[model samples]
Target: MNCRKVQYYLSTFSEGSFSSDKLSEVEVHIRNCKSCEREKFILEEILVAVRSLPTKTTPDDFNLKLFNRIYAEQNNPSESYLPTPESSWIRRPIGWVSALATVAVAALITMVFLQRPVGSPDLPLNSPAYSQVESTSPVSTPSGKHVGNRIPVSAYENIIGVSGSASNYRATNVSQVRTLRLADARVESLYVEMMRRLGAEPYPNMLRADTRYYEMRSPFARTGSNGSPLLRNAASTISY
Candidate 1:
């Protein structure tokens, strides 16, 4: 038998569990091979030492301690599987990011509301001003000519047709008035465009002069003539 085969059967031989034929073969190998004989002797010495050592007995409360540990784990599983320090540190930054995002959203909403103009509504083209002008009583000129209230005439109209000097002056005044109206219109358009882009309401001062004129003619005018306290309060609120 080879040394490997002898060693393989060595434990069975020590226990008297090997067949007689295999035992005889292992003994022959160990007797002839010095390495096998030395290994056999060492194994026998180890086995003897192991058998000579005292066997340790479990404590009477060992089962109780194990049962208590299992019960505690079942009662509070989270305590047993608590997050590590590194994981907690990583989560803290995420919480801070969420808080910051919430604060930023709130601030943006507040800013939008602050920028919004109060009580601003879209103005109609055929508003009350045009209607008022159409409904006004007609005025008659000195030459028995009746003119519509909607037509704006120059104060120098009589002289405008009579002399070149008056005509040029009238033309210059009309041009200046047209230029001023055009400039105001341009400014109003720009202000409206800016309000639209910002999602904000238009300011009261940005309204056209005709619109303001008609608004003043409303029954709710701030002159305190209508004897309405509500109108007076509303006018006071919007005066600035």
Candidate 2:
């Protein structure tokens, strides 16, 4: 065996488990190679030093004391509980200032909203006069139910209209819209099958009944087909 192979087995040999053939190889290499012999001597010294380390001995009451301490921690808890010093009064002012800043931001937002003129033309995106509706009416009514019987959502005070004369004008009503029941599972399945026949993957999670009501306002986009930009159709959870 080469010196490298013998060196590889040298550790195993030191542990007293090398095969006779491997040991012979190691012995021959150590005798013939000074470098291998030096390495062997170093390994022996390391093993001896490691074995000579002072062994830790437990006192007769070690287990009792350890268990008692643990029990005391569990029962009393004072030993483990470190009380942090109360923050310095000077430092507290900064925290108060930060809290005031956050509150001020919130107040500013509320004031901006409240100060906004009702019926003013400015409307934000996704501003679907949802405040007009109170809650989604989950009742099962017969077809052709009276419109007044339906729950009323918040209404839009501001009405957007075309710039020209009344007859030449168009208007977008920002109002909460009721979700369409058309996306029912059966209808969705039919749509998926139709798409499959056309060799297109059905939209991901397409079968789920998801609906959203978009803002009723003139599209911010300058260029689009006539005044009506298609509203985003997606599910909207009305927050009370």
Candidate 3:
């Protein structure tokens, strides 16, 4: 028999539960194997120590204390299992970071939508009105005069008319002019409002402290120089 068989039968040998033939085989192995003899001695020592240990009894109030703790935890879970202030400090900053990131993303999306072009098929680039509006750049007026950052003369003409025609025009022609002027005023107001909404200054002169041109300008005024409050309100409310 090997040392493995001797160790396996060690417990049965102590209890005298092995047959005579198996006992002879385990004894032969243990007598020849010094390691198996040492293992058997250690197992005997462990059994003796276990038998000598005093029995420990539960305290009379042990069950009552355990139940009370469970009940208290159930009734006031937060107070019983609240995290430390240091752990809360670590978590609060992460929540604030997430909120700030969300706000930044929303702001970026708003900016992108506002900055997107408001062009459409009705306002195609080749259209005369579109070309005229684009050609009326801030470089020069229709009267061949250089006026830096001033409203274009074409825009002014479209709204009010060329100079010296206001008094000579007939009543029938005046009515037609008024209609055109109102339309032009609405367009200019819509442009200015769009620029303002997108966080831009359409004309730098309008922002000047000493400049009263914004109020005097027909297109910029509440009325299109015709005292039309309804037209002014409609212009102001134009959407992109």
Per-model TM-score, in order, reads 0.25, 0.28, 0.25
- Per-residue lDDT, model 1, residue 9, is 77
- Position 48, candidate 2: lDDT: 98
Number of clashing pairs per prediction, in order: 0, 10, 0
lDDT of 2 at 226: 50
- Candidate 3: where is the Cα deviation over 4 Å? 60-240
Q: How much does candidate 1 score in TM-score?
A: 0.25
lDDT (tens digit, per residue) of candidate 1 on 1-240: 777888887787878787788878888888899998888788889999999999999765454344445435533555777544434533687768755764565465445445544221122336543343234465443454554442232211211111111112222333333322322223333333343343344433323333353334333344456543332332332211
Rank ordering of all candidates by lDDT, starting from the highest: 3, 1, 2
Please provide, for model 2 over 108-210, each residue's C-alpha lDDT reduced to its tens digit, 9 standing for 90 to 100: 5445546655442233333333222222443222343233433321122211111111111123122211111111111223333433444344333222211
Instruction: Using TM-score, give the best candidate's number.
Output: 2
| RMSD (Å) of each candidate, 1 decimal | 37.0, 22.6, 32.5
Q: Of the pair 1 and 2, which is ahead by TM-score?
A: 2
The candidate 2 region of ten consecutive residues with least summed lDDT is: 160-169
Residue 79 in candidate 2, Cα distance off native in Å: 13
